[model samples]
Target: MRWFIFIAIYILVDIYAFQAIRTLTKNPWIYSIYVFLSLAVLAALIYQVSTLGAGKVLDIKSMYVFGIFLTVFVPKLLIVVFMFGEDIARFFVGIFMKVAGSDEAQFMASRRKFVSTIALGIAAIPFASLLYGMIQGKYNYKVLKYSLEFDDLPEEFDGFTLTQLSDVHSGSFDNREKVEYAVNLINEQQSDVILFTGDLVNNLAEEMDDWKQLFSSLKAPNGVFSILGNHDYGDYVKWDSAAAQAENLRKLKNIQNEMGWNLLLNENRFIEKNGQKIAVVGVENWGLNGFKQAGDINKACEGISNSDFKILLSHDPSHWQAQVKDSPRNFQLTLSGHTHGMQFGIEIPGIIKWSPIKYRYKNWAGIYEEFGRYINVNRGFGFLGYPGRIGIWPEITVIKLKRKKPQT
Candidate 1:
């Protein structure tokens, strides 16, 4: 039923867009070529979908297939929308002419060539942008640094640098050398501790099999601590059985352990410096509305005191908004990355940072402060669904902790 609806929508939009193209170019040869190309693209899309079936895992081939579909269909959809608007206006104009008893034929205008040209011109923008995103934007890794000051920060831990990488989604990576380079970049930061807020794989645990050694190289004096993201639970894919899904999660935990990462599951670990201690609490993936809610902040902070400076690692920023911000225990800082900024957005430091994901998530990207608490939602370290990123490139966040000096 879903596929039927999708096909119906696609065919309607394609027909509309082809009509607009026909208006722009009346040459028979040009129209023939356009029709042939459209058919070829449609055939390829059908073949890809049929081969993948309903349980698509989104491997490299699947990524390319989806990318091709987006590149071809998105622009056509836009063109169809514009053409539909023009048709509606024309219909209303004809109705008004008939009601006013005027010569409708005199005022009636056919679909203008200029309108078609304009539609094509506007559609080209996203087509070009998406192509660029698939080719170069996904691998364009950027390091974002922040210095956060807090009155409650322990003096001994002042200037403590922490590096965070989130949403690795190892299943989506097609290049090894590029990933290795990213690993080297993380190591160069020389952070006191490395934190990974999750989405290590798209679904299955095997996605990280080849990348384990590469990620194992990530090191810090205080060690790497990680928490599971929504994808790690195998919730998005179909499983053979409940046991099989449970086993997949168990293996993922084992893989994290093998990589020397402390996979904190609704628990807390302390990082001590010069006898001053700060708690690093981690919770399983917890999100709002339809997403899994396995994270328990209260349980994770069980033994810790409010006086002890604390940082919480939760995958979704919504968790911070839903529970952490107004919790009885004040969590000074939280790190998250489930948004991925929709893997597309315009982010110009200090000027503007915007993504459509904001409409769905309040704290979609970067540092958000509420009630004196801070949550840094890392834009993610890898690409997923669309196979690439646009203005919102992959991110590696480095946070420097500072102790605020008392005013005299």
Candidate 2:
């Protein structure tokens, strides 16, 4: 039924957009080519989606197939919108002319070539943008830096810095060179410690087999700490036995250990400097939207005190809003990455920052602060459903902890 609706919508949009093409060009060859290509794209999309297994990971080939569909469909959808608007106006004009006793021929006007031309011209923008995004925008990595000042921050860790990475859907990655470049970029920050709020694989442990060595090279003096995201449990995959699913998760945990990452599972570790210490608490995946709730904040905090400057690593930002914000235990800062900024949006720094995902998640991207506590939702280190990123590029976040001095 869902597939039926999808095909119906695409065909309807394509037919409407074709009206504009016909108005602009009477050439039979152009019409034949356009219809042929549109049908071919539709067929490919259906085949690609059908082949996707229970895991629904969208590997490299699937990614490109979906990418092609978007490149063609988006522009045509826009053209349909414009053409539909013109039809509505024409309908009203015809009704007015008939009421005024005008001739039938004069009552209804021909479809305007100018309107079709304008619609086609405007539609080209998204067509070209989607193509560019698939080609170059996916690997466009950006380093986001933040210096957060906390009155209770330990003085010994005043300039302490940590880099946070999250949502590495390794199975979706196709370019190893690009992955290597991003790995090197993370190390270049040279943070005191590297914190990974996870989604290490799409649905399998072996997804990371090819890229393990590259990621293992990531170095920080204080060490690299990580926690699981919802995807780590192999929840989306079908297994022959329950044990098989559990073993997949076990392998992922072991892989992280092999790469020298401290896989914190509902536990806390202290980063001591001189005599002062701060807590790094990690929990399993916890989300509000029926997602995995394996995370236990209270258990993770364990013997840590409220006075300790604490950094919490949880995968979904929704966790912060739901539990962390009002908790009696003070989590000074929280880091997460699951939204991926919807992998598409219009962001112009101070001017504008918006994505469709924002309607679902208030703190979808960048940093959010409330009641003197901060959470930076990393835009993600990889892509998922959408093969390419439009505006929200992959992120590597560097956060510097500073102690606020008391005013005299």
Scored by TM-score, the top model is: 2
Clashes of each: 0, 0
**1-408, model 2: which lDDT tens digit per residue?**
999998998889999999999887789999999999999999998998888865555577888888899899999988988999998987887798789888756334345677898899998988888888888888999999999999999889999999999999998898889999999999999999999999999889999999899899989999999999998998888678899999999999999999999999999999998999999999999999899999999899999998888999999999999999767898899999999999999999899999999999999999899999999999999988768898999999999999998999
Model 1 vs. true fold: TM:
0.92
Query: In model 2, where do residues sit more than 4 Å from their true spots?
Result: 53-57, 95-111
- Candidate that scores best on lDDT: 2
Candidates' C-alpha lDDT: 0.91, 0.91
- At residue 103, give the lDDT of candidate 1: 83
Q: Candidate 1 on 1-408: residue-level lDDT in tens?
A: 977888788888888999877876679998888778777877777888788777656677777878878888999989998988988987998899889988866444454566788899999999999999898889899999999999999989999999999999999998888888899999999999999999999999999999999999999999999999999999877777899999999999999999999999999999998789999999999999789999988789889988889999999999999999977799999999999999888988779989999999999999989888899999999988889999999999999999998999
